[model samples]
Target: MKCPKCNSEIQTENINIQADIAQCNKCKNIFKISENIEDVIDDNFIVNNKPNGTWYKSDFNKTIIGASTRSPIAFFLVPFMLVWSGGSLGGIYGSQITNGEFNLLLTLAGIPFIIGSIFFWSLALMAIWGKVEVSLDNKGGKVFTGISTIGITKHFLWSDVSSIKEGQANLRYPGGKGVSLVLEGAKRISFGSSLKEERRYYLLRAVKSVMNKNR
Candidate 1:
């Protein structure tokens, strides 16, 4: 096969699946590709993300990468969650023990507060520690995003996917952008908007390149 970047003859020995990369001797450009290098889009694309705070993984397997969902609003919500959860739980348990009885009216009144607290607290924590992992495997793609094992997973083959591009970001967080996967028709799945631009672009390119390679 010819080098995608330089269009020069590439020796078969230079293409090694185990290495997951190739270097063009003519232009001295490096790239990641499958056996059919010609089908690769932007073969010379470089991923510069490295040592990026707590989420950095020097050994970031190109096939699988995670984007964190951390947000500045989460930090602001920390104090609110503490006070809200304390009040909600304290009222429920205090009434139960003080009256020596689980008053249905008091319990019902506290339930909504408890639920709200839990929901917001969970969202806050997720914003702090949650991550979405995108993988290029199986028929097309697989995505898992969550706080630990308690998140969600999505699976879809390439045939079912129509477009992979940048998606809308949550307006609450300014300057945030997300990656969206549009299915064959109207269905769309979006994730990882809070990530940095370079990270999002890498994900978009990785998926598109693999998809083209499959085709």
Candidate 2:
């Protein structure tokens, strides 16, 4: 097999009865042979080393729950409905005051404002429930946020990742949530917390594992 780090030929040396470490003879690098290599490796039984720099692929299908799911109702729908109802009520009041004829200029001005509110509200709703897809490749990765089936994709180099920290913290936007991940420097580019605790632990471990192997 080829060494993931340097694309050199990897040779396995038996370390114990049940374990063997794959070492790259050229680069003098070693990585633990994972038991789940079948799922992790590509069609050729080599790790998925795509053009982008990610050693693994993780797709998060986050269910819209809590406040993030309700933000449309609270921030957009409620306010728009209230404003529209108020405008209708105002038009009726103005018509009554003007002896059965509504003021055309007042009603016309309100119409545009109401329409603009609807547009703005729809955009806000779109922003709330948007599905964000984050892809990490060999070069880099990106967070794609939108309602369309295809999510956004971003690319970054391995060197661009300054640091990887692991911990639990409450997240914003969706709110009332805690997440864990191998953070890249100060920027929170992707959602790491969605992974199961064990999976997340391994993900963080994998980041450190690759980093140590590269170093």
Candidate 3:
């Protein structure tokens, strides 16, 4: 096949192979080759059949995170702190009533703790659901979080991606094993966990194929 980006001929020779990736000496682009190649590549094409856009879409079949699993120990502490602050206020109020001395200063002391607890809870909830969607298309690529799309910061033509890096790392949560893609421009993207090693390798091959064809 012809290289999609440079119009160079793509020659394949099998070398040391990993579960998910292979090295191509011709144009030197490592990509993923999987069942989802069609879905990841953009449909739009130029007169020469080259992809025209900069975005790629990847749909993960596995669960990223669920509400049940995402709820950390800190989540339950919010209510506890609020209740404790309320109890402190009650204690101060009762002491003032019996002593005939109104201690307004002591009652206000719990306000900061209550506010801080609420803020912590809010942040934890946000972190639990936030996930990055890694995708590729004719336009190029994107990482999506909710309604926001984060574009790949490094600029490289599809021809420039040379290698794929695969490894595992502990993620913050939601996802466990990490899969990474190292492109020619030193741009890298990773996903998955140890539980999905097979899927991760498949994804690596699919990306390698795409990058090779593009380059």
Candidate 4:
């Protein structure tokens, strides 16, 4: 581009973005760039798909996404367990399951039933006493999943995140897909997507909105 005063050409390569100033090669004239520093703290983050009822908080620069296993499935399991116990105790309970008459082989043969019981019970336990949370900022993010204060946390830099999109898990459950981050190094990070459908999309869009503002 030509300098306004001397009409001498200036190379675009030498411009400083943050400094917002450029120097003319011939005249040594320093001129300010028209660019302005932007602040990402705004309501734009929530205008997109907002969650129906999951917990959320944002301090503008830092966004926190979280949910407890408070799904109705938790409540549903109560009646289910009651009905199962009522039926199972009538005959099968004393007859085989809680009875010493069943041999080790028979007990061993019911491993599938044991596993299924454990799965359902675990789900109920988590629903009553578990939480999953994510903290996102301009530079990095963290995901926490656990019961109460005990759980695992995964950390990642925003630069390492290639993209955020909806991803399907290998499981065969409904709403198995969730917002996931694709890393530059061929790894994937999922923030416990077993949440409701509204929360899933809200998380996807919020992450995208924050990352876009940083850009």
Top-lDDT structure, candidate number: 1
Residue 45 lDDT, candidate 3, scale 0-100: 26
Every candidate's CA RMSD:
8.9, 10.6, 10.9, 10.2
Residue 122, candidate 2: alpha-carbon lDDT = 45
- Mind giving the per-residue lDDT tens digits that candidate 3 earns over 1-215? 33334434445453323444433456676544343233234323211231222123333421111111133433554466557655665576667777889666875875676676555544344334433334455545533333133222333445445555565443433333344434445455443332234334444455554554444
Model 4 alpha-carbon drift over 4 Å, by segment: 1-50, 60-62, 82-102, 127-130, 150-152, 174-185, 213-215
Please write out the lDDT profile of model 4 over residues 1-215, one tens digit for every residue: 44434545567875675887767788887766552111122345555435655566788678887766457777777678556644544344355755557566655655665566666666666666766677888888887867776777888887667666666543322223433433233446765555666665566556655655554
> Candidate 4: TM-score?
0.58
Backbone clash numbers for all candidates listed = 2, 14, 27, 0
Off by over 4 Å in 2: 1-4, 7-9, 12-20, 31-40, 43-129, 135-139, 149-157, 162-177, 180-215
In Å, residue 96's CA in model 1 sits off its true spot by 2.2
For residues 87-153, could you state the per-residue lDDT of candidate 1 as single tens digits? Answer: 7778787869877987888788888888888777866876788776777654666777788888778
Q: What tens-digit string does per-residue lDDT give for candidate 2 at 45-128?
A: 222322222234333522111111223334655566567756664565556676876676766666766676665554445445
Give residue 51's lDDT in candidate 1 (0 to 100).
Answer: 22
Worst 10 residues of 3 by lDDT: 61-70
Task: For model 1, state the Cα shift of residue 150 in Å.
Answer: 2.3
Residue 162, candidate 1: how far off, in angstroms?
1.8
Q: Candidates 1 and 4: which is better by lDDT?
A: 1
Worst 10 residues of 2 by lDDT: 61-70
Candidate No. with top TM-score? 1
